[model samples]
Target chain A: MAIDRSHIGVVSEPREIDVEKGQLRFFAKATGEINPVYFDEEAARAAGHPTIPAPPTFLFSLQLGAPAKRGDIFDPENGIGVDVRRILHGEQRFTYHRPIYAGDRMTLTTTTTDIYDKKGGALEFITQKTQGVNAAGQLCVEMQVVTVVRNG
Target chain B: MVSPVQYVDTAALAVGDRLPDHAMGPLNRGTLALFAGASNDHVPLHIDSDFAKAAGMPDVFGHGMLSMAYLAQMITHWVPQERLRTWNVRFMAITPLYATVICRGEVTEIFTDNGERLARLSIGSWIDDATQTLGGEAIIALD
Candidate 1:
């Protein structure tokens, strides 16, 4: 199915998350990252981080899991299949305000910024605007992610 | 067991110092798919080889974040695993997984003030077959 570019816009759905140390450590281990800075707080502070720093890609685990809107780009009935086997990661970019540490509770509001059809697939550009204080609410980390959709 | 020590000596680093070349690639569908699942980004572009072929791509590509994650792995190797405070990364273009890509980084600047040490580095991923699929940079903080 061909997609109309104009249909793309902001997807305003609210999602909340609380950062957990164990989960963050799991991410580090899953990625095969053996950084003590991620598991040992003393090592982290000794190394310069205020606390154990979350991996750059670990932010995805914190998404609020809100449902994508109807008439939206990746909606199954709208054309794209929800099947995991049919999809692949097209590209991802991250901009960080600060390194995420354990105990940071945050909320994220993701908006679909753009959707375009290129040759045989669709591109979903999403901007996840997140804002929340750290355990002390002293710092905030904001990020945006882009996903590609292919015809399965 | 003694944990591995992956560290960078900010005092020893200079602007334009390039990291040793690290190679990764010939990516498989399984790795890409699993990465998507683990990352909660189940987009079809990386998992569906058929979908990618239909879309005119040579083949399925790796997750952009996955690539960035791999780059971060390199940083972990260079700097003592314990010193990283925070890091930010960005992507310039799509990197394919069909061929080997050489990931490289250069220290752009290093500075310390008030007992805090910091370094800004420019990192990139280049296709071993060609200088294509150029990636991005990382700003890292250290103790």
Candidate 2:
């Protein structure tokens, strides 16, 4: 069967994820980052942000959608054998439209962009892009996330 | 003004030591493209100079996860592999490619769970020119 090229740009349901302080704080410590723009509200304000901005890699927490909901591409029931334990992060890439702030409201939409069959395991690519906007409708951030799956 | 922290003793790094803050430069399209090529991420938004302008960005942007990975690389580079059990990260903000960004981290809590010492870590990257860009926490196990 030929791969459907149109599916690459297919849109999925909009997933909403709230931004909070504690989780952002935890992420900062875990990555060993000390940028004041992530922690100091005053500093962020002085720097012209609405509030303290979270780190670049914090997009993984936003539950854009579940694997099953992603259809046969990530379907654990039938399509590909879904095994979590044996999986390793193959790679991740991000392209930002703007910066994000603490009080920003974020909406994530995920699409099963692509899938490849490897000799050892199936390599799946999931792209979740979160678009954040302030109350003023100004775009604050554009976050893109990807992950790899391996048979456990 | 923020003051740089000088750790007196490496052993004194408890579960709550915060690293000194540092400033990065203004990000640009050229730098973002460099990172994209170096990391093998060729998304048009990150490399195609014209595409970025079409998308309304001044220039191509950097990969947020790449920035996160940079911090991860820093941690592993500073600490030995034997002291690490596992590492993971998430990208929260759009770290523009050529934009200058400040990366920093802190130790929140440390504990021994199931016969393994673990460190709760927090880290983030901020666009120096802009206000906020990215941040996240990690769980590190010590052997």
Using lDDT, give the best candidate's number: 1
How far is each candidate from the true structure, as Cα RMSD in Å? Answer: 5.6, 18.8
Poorest stretch of ten by lDDT in candidate 2 chain B: B3-12
Per-candidate chain B TM: 0.78, 0.73
Candidate 1: tens digits of C-alpha lDDT, residues B38-75: 66656666788788787667788876676676676787
Global CA lDDT computed for model 1: 0.60
lDDT of 2 at B59: 65
Interface RMSD of 1: 4.6
DockQ of each: 0.26, 0.04
**Prediction 2 global C-alpha lDDT:** 0.52
Those runs of model 1 whose alpha carbons end farther than 4 Å from true positions after fitting are A1-13, A18-26, A36-53, A64-105, A111-129, A132-138, A145-152, B80-93, B110-118
After superposing all C-alphas onto the true structure, candidate 1 shows an RMSD in angstroms of: 5.6
